[model samples]
Target: MNQTIQRRLYKLYSSSSRSSFGLRNRISSLGWIVVCGLPLCAFMASMYPRDTFFQLLGVVSAVCIAAFVSVLLRKAQLKVRRLLPRHASVGRPLEYTVEYTNLAKRGLNNFYMLDLAPDPTPSMDVFLHATEPGEEKRNAFDRFFLAYRWNWLKSRFLLMKSKLFLANSVGGEKCGKVRVELLPLRRGVIHLQNMRVVLPDALGLFQRVKRVDQEEDILIVLPKRYRMDSFDFAGQARSQVGGDSSTSTQGQSGEFVSLREYRPGDPPKHIHWPSWGRTGKPILKEYEEMFFPRYGLVLDTAVRAEQEEVFEELVSVAATLTSEMDTDQSLIDVMFIQQGAKVQTVGKNVERVEAMLELLASVEIDPVADWAALKNAVLKHADDLTTCFLVFGDWDDERENFLQSLSSFGISLVVLVVQDEENPVKLNSDYTEITLLNVGEIEQGLASIHL
Candidate 1:
């Protein structure tokens, strides 16, 4: 019975306003009404006759009822379509157009529209961090007092504050457009659900809303990218033994090959003017394999329960490097383990920067075996790579040994270990390639690195 009541309350809160003000706003408005109305009623009772005071109260109640009825009787037929981008980025504002067509005979006025965006999934870290004995006991004690449920309710209300809302007025049988702006707080798939339209009474005391069901559209928000212009990886491109030129970027010295479609980062001088004249399309001349610098991006996916934030910082670092590094000059192979060992190449005409960030946004922490699998996957390309960037969640003997192994294989290594405050930044003076970055201070760390 308590659960049922909570559910009903939640529904009422969600439906109260298109702005998503929820129950808190409703209660505040009621309090203000009583605070002001009671004083007026008391003054009238003292100064005016009893009959007059009662008549004034009755007139006010009738007016409120009439206003509510006016809104309740209103009917509108609306057709809505969302024009959104293919993807959005975290902490960036995403603007999309919502086109609405009013099919009702009468116009709509003082109505607000809200796009129903799904909530983000809770991270496993939240549950795992609370698994300690003391924490668990505290949680059990809180549950006994129903504090857990209250906390959940508070979280739900806070989540509603992030929803997007727009207000507009449209004439009968006319088309209107509303630009909606949303700032995503995290990286994930943002699913757009139904749209709610709230029509308030003329007095603005009550609102009646209608929900227009929409075909869900999913938008993936990529992880945040930072500036890493000062960072550099030293390497040399290996010669291709056989097959076609596998280099994604243009070679500094190579024989001219056949002409192909032009890529975004391709140098303008490489454009084949003759081919463009003949084919009436932009084309670029390919080149033989030359000194193509190939770098391996080794991402550590094995994160402990409490290291989720560090893992997220690792991902953002990868994304930043992927964006800042000129793929037109070198090839970067991003290697990580999801369900299994997977490698994604970004350089030349292989893949775009957006594709790489999308992959990073969805990567989750895996088991230790998965990390081992990633090592094996990188070894397969060992011969081709001249340098490797190792991004680790923590630095232990196992990780140190792995870096040493890579160094022994003639592969120059640049290591970045993400650490928390409790874990002080410690560097082995012997390994010049290693750098320690505290979580949330990545920009400062990168700027401090001279090479």
Candidate 2:
């Protein structure tokens, strides 16, 4: 397709999608009556058997035309406020309440409210470049024109289900509450900005839609998580500096050894009030060296386009470990590479595990694996790590080299390779620490691990 023509077609396709959704949602039961009568009206009018047939068609057409005009005659103003939850997970129903206040003098009646999320429209460049999986298998016309590409992008956004809630009435200068439930199709932030309120006329043929500008708020949708049992990993805990105190932001802390005069830079928490009161001077508590174990959770972001599902399964696998692990015993570092290697820690005194879940929720696949950078990121903290759990979409040379590199530092390694049934992974016979998990068989594969 020509670039200029595709750009024009993109605009047409986008407008058509929005118009289709609007027309379908704004029509009432009586509206369908007019639609069903159209064919009959055409057939009867064409028969020419009698003048009465033409007269009947004219009468029906006038009524439908009058209803359309009547539906457009009404006016309304409303203030909408939507209450959203702090977080929602994919495949879960996010139920919230919407409060509508009548801002106009007249009472609002026989209306419904339709909650909306931002449309996930694909850019022209993406539409042109990205192909739906198996797109080449389609017919020549479809493959040439990219017909399914439009449907794929539309379907991706439309996967979220939000229903219209009916309301009998809301009196003038009054508020009404309607519960709205939305099933999120994907994980990430759901931005709520505008809502649609439909007011149907007495005939119920059509409705007047009023757009309400809502105060934009976001709801974080966490990635799907699987139920996991306690499991042991080949990774071991390494002795950490300041022991458990390493988990806290304070410089260094351990068991009480003695009391010392307060230094200018001593943390507030380390101040000994009793000793200070006894000596009539500021004093600080000193402690001995400590030992705390930490673990590393490495996720391979190097994914090919065909292995998108494998990547999702890998994330769920990582999420399962992140949420199910006993963080109290140690700190966990979730590491992945996007443009560069990044690591975030979760455990006692650090960010909660939910924080890591949020990261996984938004993590995208790196275009290419900078294995050197990722290894360096892990190696920087290798001394504090007891063991490392690695998740990969493929067991290739890059991954095998990565494993060997980390193992060289004496870090116990457990590698999980998500397999695609169409292209089964070849297990390296020498590596016994590898776990093979099929794409759709994740639950059963992980079921074998228990403490």
Candidate 3:
């Protein structure tokens, strides 16, 4: 095995004492030490007259007993391996099992284990129990190696592994491992760190916790869901300069068209069979390709649209729109209002629009910049923009002017105002105003815009 691989699999050292604190171990240790020391000290004071040698013998006796107990403890080693789910989806519950094996000479009786998880993993229920020798259990709590406890004092051993447990005998002694399964509730990359296993000495006294050195990382990506419906491409097919009508966007009706005579290098689908039959020549059937009107998703990513969740909804809407365009083979463009410089697409590539949406997820809205400047930048691609979806938190006179002038460009417009109810500026309502109370409504409401 590689050095890096070994480091990830078998690490069992702790750096700080404070990192291993648990309530049960502290109380037991304190009680035992106090009980063992107070009586011995009082006896030594009374016996000093008889012989000071006896007093020295008492202190040595305590040291010997502690050392003997420490040496008597069975040597234990813990191993952790992560078994992740093969098929996982974002926002869905996915199981991740952490299997722990204990190779101790005796059972780790009533030990409490806590797994350290990073931010991405959702909260999970965990249990530790020793398995019987040669026994294999799958998703079963009855075979756990250690007992769990709610708190130190109310701790009681039960076979159920609800809050406490006792490790079953392994080989000739108590040993073996337990598996903890976790459900990931969110999408993106997740990293799992080392687990801290806390075990106290006999009689539930003096807890000692050891950190396992294993590390696990997993990635969960959500599949894209693209939409295909209600798009206009009649005028676009007719405008293709060199591409064939069957493969082109020029047409008057939004329907599939038939193929004509095939050129030398024409796509096989474009070869018209019926035309070839009637005229004894090859022809192809061509469907009119649709193109969605380009709309600049100008998010006020400046200081105003600082709420990350709200920004994500805008990006989600943008991504869904781009995916729809890609499915329909339509044309749409995007631009950011507060990104210092203008951003846009040249022709009808929906992939370019998807990239722009990802950019919107990180961009911050600016309040100092002039909205007019951004509007003018959009004018450079004014002929291409079918409409503008201005996602902002507030309404202003300048925004009204921008929308009013857009009608002259022969484009439809929709203004999505995402703001609190206490927004001071009353909207003029010259154009369609969608007050975004919830960000999720943006996509559903966008369908109403006929442009």
lDDT (Cα, tens digit) per residue for candidate 3, span 176-283? 555454443333334556456655555444555567546665534232222335544333334553332343231222445655777788678557666788998878
Ranking by TM-score: 2, 1, 3
Best candidate, TM-score: 2
Task: Report the Cα lDDT for residue 237, model 3.
Answer: 37
Lowest summed lDDT window (length 10), candidate 1:
120-129
Runs of candidate 3 exceeding 4 Å displacement: 1-211, 214-296, 305-334, 337-387, 397-408, 422-429, 436-451
Which runs in model 2 stand beyond 4 Å of their true positions? 48-63, 157-159, 230-272, 275-292
Per-model CA lDDT versus the true structure: 0.69, 0.79, 0.47
Judged by lDDT against the true structure, how good is candidate 2?
Answer: 0.79
Model 2 lDDT at residue 427? 68
Clashing pairs in 1: 237-292, 248-348
| Reference-based TM-score, model 1 | 0.73
For model 3 the TM-score comes to 0.45
Candidate 2 per-residue lDDT over residues 1-451, each given as its tens digit: 6788677778888898789878887776678878688679779878766788788788888877887888788777888888877888888898898888889888987788887767767878888778798888889888766768888876665536677788658888898898888898887777877588887766788888889756887888888887755465432233544344333122243578888998898788989999888999999888885545577899988988767788888888888888876665557898998889999999867889989998998898886889999999999888777668888888778788888888888876777888999988876646677788998888787877532
RMSD score of candidate 2 (Å): 4.4
What lDDT, from 0 to 1, does candidate 1 have? 0.69
lDDT of 3 at 340: 62
